[model samples]
Target chain A: MKKTVYRIYTSIIFLFLYAPIGTLMVLSFNSSKTRAKWGGFTLKWYSELFQNDAIMKALWNTLAIAFLSAVFASIIGTIACIAMTGMKKKWRSVLLGITNIPMLNADIVTGISLMLLFLTFGFKFGFLTILLSHITFNIPFVILSVMPRMQGLNPSTYEAALDLGAGPVQAFFKVVFPDILPGVLTGFLMAFTMSLDDFIITHFTKGAGVDTLSTKIYTEVKKGIKPEMYALSTLIFIAVILLLLLANSRSKIKSVKTAERGKS
Target chain B: MNKKMLSLPYLFWSIAFILIPLGMIFFYGFTDKTGAFTLENILAISQAEHMKALWLSILLSLISTIICLALAYPLGLILTSMEVNQNGFIIVLFILPMWMNFLLRTLAWQTLLEKTGVINGILSFLHLPSLNIINTPYAIVLGMVYNFLPFMVLPIYNSLAKIDRNVINAAKDLGAGNLYILKRIILPLSFPGIVSGITMVFVPALTTFVISTLLGGSKILLIGNVIEQEFTQASNWYLGSGLSIVLMVFIIINMVLSAIFDKDGEGGLL
Candidate 1:
């Protein structure tokens, strides 16, 4: 009886969580232009999403920003993690706490704060500003993810590589890089998604003509429903789902490989 | 190459993007149009409309956070009890929704809860009363909970997953009742997750203008809405920055309070 109760309760929670997205996906196929009614089933919106220049432009902008910001964040964050290891504990903690600000502060504040900085510098509020804001928030996620792997490092193997006549860069690449690669990849993927889903910061920092799917959707909602909005969202939702599944399976395979390595 | 040299780029990035931008908030927040320091902008939270908005944001966010906590704890316990330990799958399930463009999902709710929406349509089909809660605080709270529920669940479930089954079994063997075991063992161990979940839910819910905008409609004004308007519509950067500082104070208070509970930041997301 208790088990039945738990099962029923769990299903209910999952239902609550997924019902909206599922409905949106279903609606994407509906022939209805208005959200209030289901006009019938149709695939018109899916094809229309490709032809809609505004959405296609926003999609291109979103992907470019998510990809570029993730790449930069991973590089900067990984280096910072490495450098912090050699620093005095006091300064390291201070920098780490500073890193937490972008993560912990309200996104609206972070958005506004960055906006003020750009205003002061007379920077154009466009793709670059949005990219800058994304990278700022993205770095902390990379740091938090990568720092754990860095802490779990076995130092002697790295030193052994160094003493065996490998250069510092060579030693790191040979020994230290593989262990932390997972964390770095995880951080990179996280940063990418954070950028992909970011509306608040992008909304604040983006200027005329540049729109991510998120900011575009926000404006579209205010103006009234566009049929392509549902199609585009469904596509994004599917893309995210695939990305996460790939990440999960990759990690699982890695863990299995490591477990076999441990046995050997 | 000095190992510290590797951080030079990060240092420059942080100072330029992180520290200076943060300093800019303080500068704009504390100063007026002439670049002179003034408390009036910071004190704008006291205006009747601004105060109402802030008060409502806090109240609605609190309600949603509490609702999320109550809902998540039971679900976390049940999921943990099912022995789905730290597998990447369940987490992916929770996280997938969060990553799905939140604007679309929340706007979907606006449709689902509309007067002639899916729910009302279903209710009429069944000869039941329609849920007329859209465009109200309840709808806003629901939006907050929907958007942030995953944030609460993941942390709580992670912390709960860390509890050893043996300890709980040992407590049970010592004649502790289920309620007693929950109170004495499970509750304290999950404190970090709970605290983390609260702040995770609270801070975002507290400052969300979008959720209120989409779900509550233009009739409702949250502090986030007020600040957003000050920047976008009014173009009052100083006042916008000033009001943001007030939000930051609340966020800091939340972080400090959670820090007291989860000192090692154990309440962090999975």
Candidate 2:
């Protein structure tokens, strides 16, 4: 009886979470201008999404920003993690707390604060400022993802490589890099998703004439309701789902490989 | 020389980008245009009505956080108990609305809750009175809960999934009822997630001007709107900085109070 009730309850909760997105996706394909009624199914919205230059441009811009921010954040976040690992424990914890303030800080506060700094410094809102800010927020996630793996890593491999006449750089490149590559990749993927998904900070930092998909969506929503916006949202939702699947599969493969390694 | 060379880039990044900007925010909070620091301007700006706004923002945030927790606790438990199939689907459902641009989501809610929108249409179709949820405190809460539900759910889900089933089974085998088991066992174990989720929800809800601006339609004035006005319209950096500081302090105080107040039965670390 309990099991039956549990199953029913769980199904309702899942449906509650998913039903809205499913409705949105279905409405995107609906030929009706209004979302209230399902008129007829057509591939017209997807075609409309493709032919829209502004949407295409925004998609490209979003991808470019996500890519640039992810790469930079991974490199910087990984180095920061490595640097933190060598620090005194008490000092390290303090630094960790300090670095994590951005994560905990309210988005409006952070966005406004960064906006103020940009104005004060006379820094133009463009690719570089947005990238830097993205890295700032993305770094915490990468740090969180990579730090645990770094802690679990056995340091003896690097020591063994050094004792075998390998220079520190050579030892790091050949030994340490391969072992931590999965964690670093996971961090990179996380940063990419975060940068792609960012709205509030991007809205504040994006100057005139520069727009990501998020900013574009915001503008569209304000200017007028458009069915193309739903189409674009559906596309983004699908892309995120695909990437998440790829990440999950890759992590599963890594887990199996690690299990095999342990057995051997 | 080698170590310094290696550390130079990081030092420059942290100092120039992070530390100095933070210092500027602090300095600008105090100083005037001539760069002389004074509390006069800040003090003059903090009137009784501004105090009311501060309290209102805090109260609304507290309420919204509670609602999000009430919704999320059951939902999080359900997510954790289910078999993992299409987790990507589940995550996307949870995260896409959050990712889709906050303004757009707020606008969608506005559309959905509009007098002519789906909710009213459905109500009227069912021979019920069309309710006016927009431009109310309830609307503000609803918008906030919709936006921040995922934040609350994710942390609690993470915690619930991490709980050992054997412990739950042991409690059940000892003839503990579901309610007692949840109250004594599950809730205690998930306190960390609850703490994290509450913090996440409260902080954002406190400063969410967009929701209030769009849905509440000037009915509710949050601290965020006031800060926005100070920076953009009023051009009073000193007052804005002072307000920012006050808001931050208020948020921290609320956090501490809630932490103490909420963790009654559970052994939670302050």
Candidate 3:
């Protein structure tokens, strides 16, 4: 009885969570422009989503910004983590505290602050500003992810590489880099997702004619959201699901192999 | 030793982007258009419109945070009690909805709750009372709870999962009943998670303009909406920055509380 109750409760929560998403997926195939009644199912929206140039552009911008910001943030964040590992304890904590500012502060404040900075400097609120703002926010996420792995690095192996006559750069890369690769990958993925999901920050930082899918959706809110957007969102959702599944399976296989190796 | 120099780029970046930008908010917030330092902008929060918006934002966010806590704590408990393999998959399932666009998700609720919406359609078909809460504070609260529930759940679940089973077993052996154990051990142990979850939910819900704008309609104003309008529509950066500073005070209090409770940073998403 207890187990059944737990199962029922879980099912209700899951339904509540997915109801919106399921509605969106259903609406993508909706033939009627209006959401009130379901018209007969049609695939026209999917085709129309592809044909819509402005939306396609926004989609492209979203992907490009997510990718670029993640890559840049990963580089800077990993380097920061390495530097932090060598720092005095007080200074390291201080830097980490600063890093948390973007993470802990409300998005509106961060967005507004960056907007003030851009305007103060007489900079245009365009792709560059948006990218810069994203990179700033993304860096902390990357650092948070990578810093733990940095702390776990065994110094002996690195010193052993040095004793073996490897150059400092070579020794660090071959010994330390591989050890922290997983953390770095995790950080990069986190940053990418954050950039892709950002709407408020992008809304403030983005200029006229520069629309991420998020900003595009926001603008369309006052006007009715287009059916093509529903189709686009459904596709994006499916893609994320597939990617997560692939990541999950790969991790499962790796864990299984590690278990087997441990038994041996 | 030379590796310490590697932090230069990040140090420069943070100073230029993070610290300097924040400083700009203070600067703008404290100054007038001619750059004269004055407290008028900051004092503007006491004005009728601004104070009402602030109070409403606080009241609604508090309600949403409480609702999220109530809903998520049980779910977290259930999740932690499950098998390890099942736990990971279930947590992932909960987080999956977050991967979708939040705007689109909120927009979905707008469709469902609108008078001519699906929920009402279903209600009328069943001869049940239609939901008239759309475009009200109740709808906004629903949207907040829906959007931020995962943030509350994840942290609580993480902290709950970390509790040692042996400790619970020891408590059971010590003649503690289920209610006593829950109240004494489980609740106290999960305090950090609860604090972190509250901060996470409360901060966003308080600062959210989009959720309120979509669900609350234009008639109801939030502090976030006021600030957003100042920056975007009104083009009054000084007033916007001032209101943001007021909002930041609440956010800072939340951060300080989370920092005090979650010292180990165990409540983080990772």
- Top TM-score hit: 3
Candidate 3: where are CA atoms >4 Å away?
Answer: A258-264, B84-87, B261-270
CA deviation > 4 Å runs, candidate 1: A242-264, B263-270
Candidate 1 displacement at residue B194 in angstroms: 0.3
All models: lDDT? Answer: 0.90, 0.76, 0.92
Interface Cα RMSD for all candidates?
A: 1.3, 2.9, 1.1
Tens digit of lDDT per residue, candidate 1, span B1-270? 497788788889889988998899888889998988899888999999999999999999999999999999999998888877555668878887866688888888977898998889889999998899998999999999988999999999999999999999999999999999989888888988899999999999999999999989789999999999999999998998889888889998998888887764444323
- Best candidate per lDDT, number? 3
Ordered list by TM-score, greatest first:
3, 1, 2
B1-270: candidate 2 lDDT, tens digit per residue: 332343344445656656666666677788887889877546644687677777778888889999889988987777777756353455666765654545655666665677887678879999999989988888888878877888898888888887899999999999999999888888888887888898889888998777787788775788888887777679787777777766767667767765675565254523
- CA lDDT, candidate 3, residue A208: 100
Q: Write the per-residue lDDT of candidate 2 for residues A1-264, one digit (tens) a residue.
A: 866777786676555445456656776888988765668998798888889888888888888989988888788777777777776788668667766777877776676677778888899987777777787778777888888888988989888999999998898789988877888998898788788878777866677888887777666654555678778877777876687678789988998899999999
TM-score for all predictions?
Answer: 0.95, 0.87, 0.96
| Structure candidate 3, residue pairs in collision | none
The C-alpha stretches of model 2 lying farther than 4 A from their native spots are A1-16, A26-45, A245-264, B1-8, B83-93, B96-99, B173-175, B254-270
